[model samples]
Target: MASNTPAPEAPFDAFGGGAGPAAPDTEWNPTEGSLRAENRSGGRHRVVKQRSNFARSSTVLGVGVIAAVGAGGLATAQEKPPVAISLPDLPDMPDLGLPDAHDLPGVGALLPQENHETVAEGRANPNPLTVATYATDDERATKAERAEPVADVQAGAGDAGEALRARILQQAEQQQASADAADKAAAEKAAAEKAAAEAAAKADAAEKAAAEAKAKAAAEAKAKAEAEAKAKAEAAAEAERLAKLGASYSMPLSSYSLSATYMQSGSMWSSGYHTGLDFAAPTGTPLKAVHGATVKSAGWSGSYGYRIVLELSDGTEVWYCHLSSMTVSAGQTVGTGETIGRVGATGNVTGAHLHLEVHTAGGDGIDPAQWLRSKGLSL
Candidate 1:
């Protein structure tokens, strides 16, 4: 048999039908008996998800804390200027049917130690929630006072963070641009210096070549002048020697008219041409030694009525033919212009004349008149 009377203390079923042991009376425990019946609107109630104020506030503040910590670590590791981090906007906490903790007096002492600063100070808490169930009154008040300035600082930090990041990027770009300019300038300067060096080298080479060419030309000119001077000196010496030698020679005869010349063609001569120079004169005209010489021969010769031969110092021989008489004998030394013979009518001659012949050391005959003229004597 079932009874309609309700139990005075029934444990609340967390699941739909399960019942647990009754809790102690000293602590609060949810139970079906403590719950009140509500009027039905002819529809089942929809279940709604719920969240605590402390958990929501902690999630919002964690993001800001993590961002700040990461920025500080990056600055330390790189040894660079500290960068500002922008924190995300924290969403407003939803109303949870609970009273606002800030409106109640001494409400911070009732909140969990984790949510004490957030609930009492009416702001997000940067510190993580602690496992402690409650916070002291003094700790809440002190933390609440500190939280004001922290909020103020954070309010301005958003704008300051963006400005700082922009400034750092701008400074980096300026440094890079300056470095690029310095590199470009250095390259241009190096190119200019190289070009100047090459030009200088070319100039030096040209100057050296020009100097060498000039030196060669000067040497050639000097050599030519020396050769000209040597030739002039030799000519002057030869002329002086000939002038002294001319004084020693003399003409064969003083007074005579020239007749046949050497190498003259005549039928009377046995040879095809006359071999001697002829001087027409009186039968007894005197003949003289043409130069200083020894008498080589003085006698009658065939075809020639009389003849005399003289040999000079240079091995030259002079012959006087058709002579009437000869004053000098064979092997007699005579001075220049001394009497040696007389003119006469000789063989192959039409009238009285003196015939003269000259022979070189090799016995080759030459023109007597030309030989005499070469000794500075006039015909």
Candidate 2:
């Protein structure tokens, strides 16, 4: 008992999926909105296939996703240029490039390129890679400029040292020369002094020899002169004595008789010789002195009985051997021709006579007559 009612069919949208079979197992019943189905295997009726909306809607959604991804990759362009960062300069270094690459012709050359400001010339490399190296070159240039003065100062110091060495050498040479000159001068002075001393010694010896010779000659001359003067004086005194004797003289008696001569032999004489002149006179006859004389002796004698003697001034004695009496005393002065005694023969005689003898001071007898004759008187 089922009821025979049909469900209503829904309205289709262009973008929706289709609904499939609805109820179980019976047979289709066509209603007012139900569609008929076809069987392809059957001869007359076949099933109807519908155009679905899912495939078309999927194609539209895929197109919209591709458009969104392409839009994100193509972003908007920037309004301003990129900002530049200045880096610190690097130290200069040796090149580190490919071997022999720098020798390639024009490899490092800059191409004709533009900047933001337009075409430019003679400017530094526009490549950002060369910026640090250019900064290093500028720093090196500054350092080289600063070191120039110090190098000049070092060069001046070297020259000053050379000058100082030269001056020291010159001073040493001058000192050596001066020392040599001084030594030479000292030697010369010593030699001169020695020569002068030798000359002085020689002169002194010569002078002393001359003085000695002069003294000897003077002594000899003085002795010779003194001897001559003494001889002259002696001769003059002899002459004076002879002159006195010539001026004063006299004979002995007034008168006398000659009895005997000298050196005659006679027996009556005492000495056996007649030593003097004899005079014969009487006992009262006066006996006279031979010269001016002193009475030497008057008295008695042994052989002549009485005797008298008269002494002259030059020490000659005259004797009257026979006398009776003496008229003068001993030591009485008598002039020439003055009576001193009387003649007598009181001794052993043949007759009365006068005996006279002459004696010199040396005790020698001479002839009385001869002595008187020499004194400017004749006996």
Which has the greatest TM-score? 1
Query: Per-residue CA lDDT of candidate 2, range 95-134, in tens?
Result: 2222111111221121112220122224333443111111
Q: In terms of lDDT, which candidate is strongest? A: 1
Question: Candidate 2: what lDDT?
Answer: 0.56
Give TM per candidate. 0.44, 0.35
The predictions' CA RMSDs to the true structure, in order, are 15.0, 41.0
Runs of candidate 2 exceeding 4 Å displacement: 1-247
Clashing pairs in 1: none
The reply for model 1, stretches above 4 Å from the true place, is: 1-233, 254-286, 302-305, 322-325, 342-345, 349-355, 366-379
lDDT of 1 at 196: 100
- Model 2: weakest 10-residue lDDT segment is 85-94
